[model samples]
Target: GCFWHHHDCYLFKVPATRTAFWLDKIAKNVARDRRDIGRLAEQGWRVLVVWECALRGRKKLNDDELGERLEEWICGGGPCAQIDTQGIGVLDVTSPPYRM
Candidate 1:
């Protein structure tokens, strides 16, 4: 059920209406995610936080490529990792160390 735990899974983009409220809400959600991740780490459970932006948009990796990367990570020995977009290539959170 760890994967079902609520975290910053949604990409909270500020809408045209209620921009201020949305910003505040997203800030709180991000803070909560950090706390939860820290707690999981303390319990020796690594967490991977792949942002929605990385999985969508014009620069996202192809589905096949994404699946390959995920498969590699799951089968590998890394404790934690995240796949994100950076420029043209995908950013490896564990290797270069990406924050949020």
Candidate 2:
């Protein structure tokens, strides 16, 4: 979820206590995800990230909508894509570099 992945979304909030520790842990997870995605792309694998918010929140798409969106992505052919409550778009693999 966004909380664990530290996604910049409505669901993620740094904890009031042990803030630094939580931030560090989340940062590591984010880094690992980026690394893995990068490696897969390097090996010629297309990736699609469907964030939880897209499925469970107030702004979620209906089943048929989500299905059609996924189908389009699968057929359209792209290096990477992301689907969230905000809608579908190319995955932003770029950001300020993360340190391990």
Candidate 2 wrong stretches, greater than 4 Å: 96-100
Candidate with maximal TM-score: 2
lDDT of candidate 1?
0.52
Give the per-residue lDDT of model 2 (tens digit) for 2-61.
Answer: 788766677778999999999899888888888888999999999888877778877777
* Clash pairs detected, candidate 1: none
Question: What lDDT does the true structure give each of the candidates?
Answer: 0.52, 0.78
List clash counts for every candidate, in order. Answer: 0, 0
List model 1 lDDT by residue over 2-93, tens digit each: 11222222443356888777666655655566566667777998566565555786656678777776777667635556665532232233
Index of the highest-lDDT prediction? 2
Candidate 1: residue 34 lDDT (0-100)? 59
Per-candidate alpha-carbon RMSD to the true structure: 6.7, 3.5
